[model samples]
Target chain A: MKTFKLGGVHPPENKLSQSAAIEVLPLPETVTIPLSQHLGVPANPVVKKGDSVKAGQLIAKGEAFISANIHSSVSGTVQKIDDVVDTSGYRKKAIVIKVEGDIWEDGIDLSKDLVKDISLSPQEIVSRVNEKGIVGMGGATFPSHVKLMVPQGKTADVLIINGVECEPYLTSDHRLMLEKAEEMLVGIQIQMKALNVDRAIIGVENNKPDAIDHLMKLIPEYPGISVEPLKVKYPQGGEKQLIKALVNREVPSGKLPIEVGCVVHNVGTSFAVYEAVQKNKPLVERVVTVTGKGVKEPSNFVARIGTPIANLIEAAGGIPENTGKVINGGPMMGKALSDINAPVTKGTSGILLFPQAETSRKPVHNCIRCGRCASICPMGLEPYLLAVLASHKRFDDCETEKVMDCIECGSCLYICPSGRPLLDQIRVGKNETGKMIRLRNR
Target chain B: MNEITLISVISLGSLGTIAAIILYMVAQKFKVIEDPRIDIVADKLPGANCGGCGLAGCRALAEEIVKKESLEGMSCPPGGNEVMGEIAKVLGLEAKEQDPTIAVVRCSGSRENAPPKVKYEGDMTCAFAHNLFAGEGGCPKGCLSYGDCVASCDFDAMYMDHKTGLPVIKDNCVSCGACVKACPRSIIEIRKRGKKDRRIFVSCINVEKGGVARKNCQVACIGCGKCVKECKFDAITLENNLAYIDFNKCTLCRKCPPVCPTNAIHELNFPPRRQRPETKAEPAEA
Candidate 1:
């Protein structure tokens, strides 16, 4: 029953896609895979146009330890590697491949049998995860191997698995928890063994009472493990927020959870880790939620990482007649795609199609200073003042107000009655402040 | 008895006089010395203390100017150019003449012209509107008309034109660049004040495809390349489905405005046009 001792808002629990079973989406004729999917540096393309690649074959390799490798989601010939508009509405280089066959990499273990035990050393396990390009898979797409390589002087005592699908309309993690509970638990154990943590905790939001109960039942054998129910809140899955909610301790700003004697991993990330450590499966596929009022069929699908959103929508009964906007993730923090042809990336969690009525914006007026934004801010920063200072280009003032601490949760925007864009301007302010700080440092 | 009392009184009075003289000498010794010009410059400042000059106050600005030999690009926004000229004269420095400009919103999509793409029920700030989604209209690049710029403008010159859903700067605009910074899309620009308050600028900021832009707003530029074709001055350039008018090369000929099929090109400060034999009535919006 523990929750973070800070601001949180409970919007309507419109968990419409919760009950929908995850369906496998049909491959499209072509998939446009973006290289800049993960958090760090963009992956370097290893294939050129007209080169044939099999599913699961590495098409892009990591250029940095913090980056993830991109694998071909479908056996196809490279169509082109060109700039394409992504969900964030920014032009980024992407790899386009035309599907030719259902050929998968020969090394993949195509089996339903559970591999409960792996005797690989922690280093070997981490190496396999790195080689397979396994990442967080919880919308962050932070390289899992990089996270496992904790900074020196910091020791992890516990590995907390985040199974909280707190954002509205995202049920990928929930469904994954229900069906892959055993595999997820195995993944958590592997992570604990790798980190040499004594205990592991799987935190689930109370909204998913069934998921919590199922995980509890499946996890009875691992006495070192426990399932803690969390207060359903937006961004509960965020690293610092989750750590605070589970352990009642705040991870200091600019420091990871492991730095505070804990390491956290997502449930989906655990599954991906399990595959990487055991079956040598790279992160080539993931579960995607294709649900919204504008979607004719609201459902979840186990989609390939580079699957085009159009293909997922088609599998879910095509785009609805009223569809006017398509977001790449949940409504709270997702980026609305200008082009539906953009493919799913490692961080893609949901493809939310909003009808015209829900997608359009209202004319902005003066802020009435309702303070709802401050009340709902998880990071405990005032967004109204931040936006004002940003509008004035007061980078120094923004820094004084701790603009760098803003987690970009969109909660302030979600609660603002006057419909202010507090996050966007704050983003600009934070960027400016960061530049000023860097310049001063240099 | 009078002699003894007089002698004691004189001794006390001498001691008192000696103490007073010593105190005065000490006070003079410790008195701090500062340049007199600091006070004179401070007194001449506007005293608004707006901090737009990056100084603490008028006194601080005066002190810095007197102490620092270089004036550089420092000027108090509230004091206008006259105060700067005075400050420069006092410091024996040259006051830089700046071009007078005003904020011009590049978007013409008002509620009547640019319909809402989605109804926003969230906060009513332009910053929030831009972050939450694209403009209320389907055009992602169009003016949000949320009035963040209008609210940010300290001067009463900028107002949200209800008909256009965009901020309009009056002739009294001081070119503070406050509105230009407030706009999330960067649609507000400090354009030169042309003769007779007339200048030519592009009205559309929509970078979406012509089909999408037209679907979002009726007044959006369709990117038909018509203005580019008609322009003989080579002042217009199109990119990302939006046309921009290069004010430097523009001759204010008003040729591009008439040739723009979508009326995306706007001409300002021009005299009333003479009646022509045939002309189309303004299109009714909404």
Candidate 2:
């Protein structure tokens, strides 16, 4: 099986929610939508506190070039606009709504039937996706419109749909591929049209054999679309890693996948894009997996954008008695929520509840110099050296070692038997060094 | 010696001397003009090259000063006030006097207050803890108790207190602020060292509610607003369930110590007062 030439670690594939079908979660009485959902800038609030908003209505608009728009997940009256704590423990301005009815926007075509063809121009499709606030649902929440906007002088040769649900214990993408195969195919075609790419590949991990077969069967109707079964691997969904795994090309450091003549989209993102372009439906809901040993029930559900995590946990039969941590995503890179009231945003993939026994509790010991972390780092960085430099307050030295390149995948942390937190210190070094560089430039 | 040999030797010698003199004259005439004040300022600097002042070295700083029109917050750490004053005099500029400060870790959550949830047996670094988890302890905001602060202390003023699992500042602390930069939690702060090394600060960084903060560390600031109410000078502001004391408005009245519910606010350097005056006096009159 061909994998990315760089380092990767295969931990146990604890995919507990693989068989769980997507169920619509019960709408909460109130929803709190935060403005900063996408990667770049925080969106500006467009609706006033007393205004009534329908499902898929534009609630917030991007204030900067790199930001994405935000939409109302449900028809509701604006209860309040106030600062709310997010999963990361930071307070951000959020829109609170008291749901009035299941009234959707009149323009949105809420049809169960899949629309195969979209007559909209490529630019119009991109604009619709942007207006609908469709971001990449593969956990990064990058603005979809921005990704679709190929930079000037650059062209996308191949569009790759990432069906590789590589992160262990998370099957949201897997279920999306299995259940929404046709929608995904249509979405892939839509993406191909947007990128003006003739050829497209949907890379699914062999673990989801059924999804591969389904996609392969449906892809024949679309001439340029094909499904390729990828060997299951952790972080195979990373844009660079997936591109390399699927196409045998390496995206150079600090370069986009497009630079290597490819564009990768997550399966869920493709489905959302399909809906956005075809039916004029905005992205308001996403599949979320609630799974772990600490939860009584492990399942996947189509969760609304602004639902609180505590409600999701309650729907999953509540946390067990000895739940040690409540992570907002997969165990490897997910943030442990300090506030259960933090609402779900666009990029949340899963809610992992780990029992105290299953949680990692190793003390920071001396580096055995095993070099395992460096061996498995996909970015080809020496995490040990960066850790040492950061430890000694040699931030400049850390910068010289290019510590900023760490993707915070938690591979180094997961592989380190000595329990050293290489990512934590490296993140600080990156931020501090960036600030220093900025100060120097000023 | 033969006449020819002597002539050759004298000719070579004269040629060498003339070339040396010409080189010397050229070196003097075409010398690159440099500001003499830069040298004077550089001489007055401590030359530790710590780069804390955002410059490369003492020479770079001197050059920048000579080139710039104004100097503000541009004092070197190793030079201290005396050296800064000297440099200021040399440059024909007035030096601004700043309060000498040192970094003091407020959180006493060493092993006793904030117990470690897991034994981190990897690289001993606060940065590692910050990235991997929020910290080593149960509190997401608590200090990692790693020696990143100690490592950043170029003056050797801060050291890890083995028993407390916290960095202790010594009298020799120069307030260089390298430790502040190194600390991932931003717990290490540069504050004025009150008379006789007395000072006050909030020890805990936990902004979680009282119960939750207490669950993580015994000394976390729960943002109960008690300190804000107790302060007579209106020096404190509570936001995001965290209390911030504005040092400029703080009167050092020690009014907040008793009011803090969680002992998150710390007071140091105040004289201990006796309950009662001594009534008896030594036999004086003969």
On TM-score, the candidate that comes out on top is 2
Using DockQ, give the best candidate's number.
2
Give stretches of model 2 more than 4 Å off: A361-365, A393-405, A417-419, A433-442, B1-99, B104-147, B159-168, B184-267, B273-286
Best by lDDT: 2
lDDT of 1 by residue, A97-145 (tens): 9999899899898686888886999998888888888888887778889
**Per-residue error at A69 for model 1, in Å?**
2.5
For candidate 2, write residues B25-144 as lDDT tens digits.
999999998888888888878787777677888899988887883467686766677887877777778889866666788677889888776555344667655655545456767777
Give the clash total for candidate 2. 20
List each candidate's DockQ score.
Answer: 0.12, 0.18
Model 2: per-residue Cα lDDT at residue B202: 85
RMSD of every candidate to native, in Å, equals 6.5, 7.6
Model 1 alpha-carbon miss at residue B220, Å: 7.3
Q: Least lDDT summed over 10 consecutive residues: which range in candidate 2 chain B?
A: B277-286
